[model samples]
Target chain A: MNYKASQMSQSKKPDADASRSKKIRQKRIGDQLRRLYDDVTNEPVPDEFLSLLEQADKSSKQK
Target chain B: MDDQAFKTELAELIPHLRAFARSLCGNATAADDLAQEAMLKAWKARASYQAGTNLKAWTFTILRNLFYSEKRRSWRRQQLDPEVAEATLVSNDNPSSAIELLSLRNALDELPEDQREALILVGAGGLSYEETAEICGCAIGTIKSRVSRARKAITEILESKMSGLTGNDSLSAADAFEDIMRQADELSRDLPADA
Candidate 1:
């Protein structure tokens, strides 16, 4: 990590400000990723998924 | 494991399987189809699975293998365009969160398949590096570097887009970062498993 977004800009912000802003940005991205994942995980496991499992179970026993 | 025990475990892991599939393909319908196929495959291969191992990791490996093989077979990079994918995956109820997720999803698309999968597995799928490396069929250090580079790349992409940085500076900066990544990759290839 270069730890400096300020390098790309002409603004003369201090290094500490640049570092803290980078950290905040990273934290936001991490949280956003976890939320994206959990949104799908939190969805109602479609009925087809449940029935498919049961169907497999029953057929295996019958065989 | 007994058939009953296997069924119990498989049922419990359904949501996770679906999530991993969705993240890989970015489509709800296709993801379910993939997840369902993996479940059946796992059931058929139940006898081969060692009992008391990491069942989630095993199933994840199965799902990921199915995803890639199917992808290779079809030769389709994307099942849905970005706009359609974003509209389908995110609800419009919360504008801010939707924007946040939509942008990341687009940024994630820019990464190579290896790095994208590596980042998803470690960063969001709640898997450890060893498990991720196993699932990805790569070195542990390779997974680390992919993830590290992915985070940096996404941050750079997102930040540049947000800050309205001058195109010339950002382009040059990106070129420099690419050079650094190539060097880092060469060095990481020989990194010890635990290093």
Candidate 2:
């Protein structure tokens, strides 16, 4: 009976630890994805993007 | 909105569109081309946009639709060079890239297109579930489930890359965290600094 009780207690710790680590894992994934995304967002808007729009506007003026 | 006002707002959204495009396509050059196309489309379609609604979401929907349509067209073309395409896929799986955290890009690339977009829209793009559903043209519940599954899948992929990863994945998951950190350092140092 005592062995069974001790085994249950030992198993319970893993469950707690697993949940804790899962949260940590999720936090890391979110952080990394946000960082990856933010890096691109922070980059200077390439010159072509604005140039393309300016060209489109110029052509539309002809119509 | 007037023509100038519409153009100004669309310009401001270009950086975000590029960011979102990069997440969708993983290749910077292709993603930039996609973003430019979407920006042009949004500009041309400005008459249809409601003045006070969520313009960001509207632009994102345009970008997402363009991406999927282009992806479909590319898939049709790729039948001509299946081997070449598969070779590219195999090379991407190679971890020899010297770029910081290429593994995360690879891991994100491995997700199914739907799940990857859903996760990026919600997880990275900071959209509400309702906004994501509208952008995806799906129900809110579907978006929630896709986001949850994507989170689980990313965790497994990132952990596998961090560990030396034998075939058995469960063992790695159940292993201690310190081992993975040590492996990460070792893997990072293997490539030459300049490479």
Candidate 3:
């Protein structure tokens, strides 16, 4: 019984390895996309827009 | 900006920025502020934005700049007190899963800011080493070392935390990390294409 159990566990290792490898690949892809998303939203309004807004605000203040 | 143009950009990037901000700031308040600041900066810099270049990468550069430049980081460091550490995983719904995730987040939070940023950018955020180097304003080797050390520290903490919590030692700690990798993979599959 002990020998059989050991063999069963040994055989299972490959299955586990294959599954884990797949996960690593998926994580890599997911991580890339996540960074892409972060970059996009990180800057909501570019500096140009902010300058324009500042100018408008100043003009209104003068008015 | 025209309604259509603003809508298009918002639709394309808001969710991602939210995720990135959440990871860095740990809660909605700071996350929103970080994202908002990044956006304001991006808008001001719009004229310099090259049309064919990656917009997302440019935006992250802006956000990271703001994060490092602000004096508020000192205050933010205090906010990361051990008292608030317990709250890290309370937001998780499942007890068992929450404990594991909370423990992980707490351990991550405990890391030095540079190490933490390195791990999040590469481990969770998924940037290539080159991209990470660009974002961090460091050499590629530095990025590699930082990420390696960050993972080692996290793994050590996770192993210790799990040891006392669960009586069963059926699988080793290495196995546990593999399991997490698998779950992350599954999450990738389940996530929306845009996500």
Structural similarity to truth (TM-score) of each candidate: 0.79, 0.74, 0.60
Most DockQ-accurate candidate: 2
Runs in model 1 deviating more than 4 A are: A1-13, B72-93, B165-195
Model 1 CAPRI quality: acceptable
Query: DockQ of each model against the real complex?
Result: 0.37, 0.43, 0.18
Would you list the rank order by lDDT, best first? 1, 2, 3
The share of true interface contacts that also appear in candidate 1 amounts to 0.76
For model 3 chain B, the run of ten residues with the poorest summed lDDT? B74-83
List model 1 lDDT by residue over B42-153, tens digit each. Answer: 9889999999999999999999888878755332346446665457446657554565576788789888889988999899989999999999998999999999999999
Clashing residue pairs found in predicted model 1: none
**Which portions of model 3 miss their true places by more than 4 Å?**
A1-63, B1-7, B73-93, B164-195
What is the lDDT for B163 in model 1?
51
The best candidate in terms of lDDT = 1
Cα deviation of B194 in candidate 3 (Å)? 36
What TM-score results for chain B in every one of the models?
A: 0.77, 0.72, 0.71
Chain A vs. true chain A, TM-score per model, equals 0.78, 0.71, 0.52
Which candidate comes out best when scored by TM-score? Answer: 1
The whole-model lDDT of each prediction reads 0.79, 0.75, 0.61
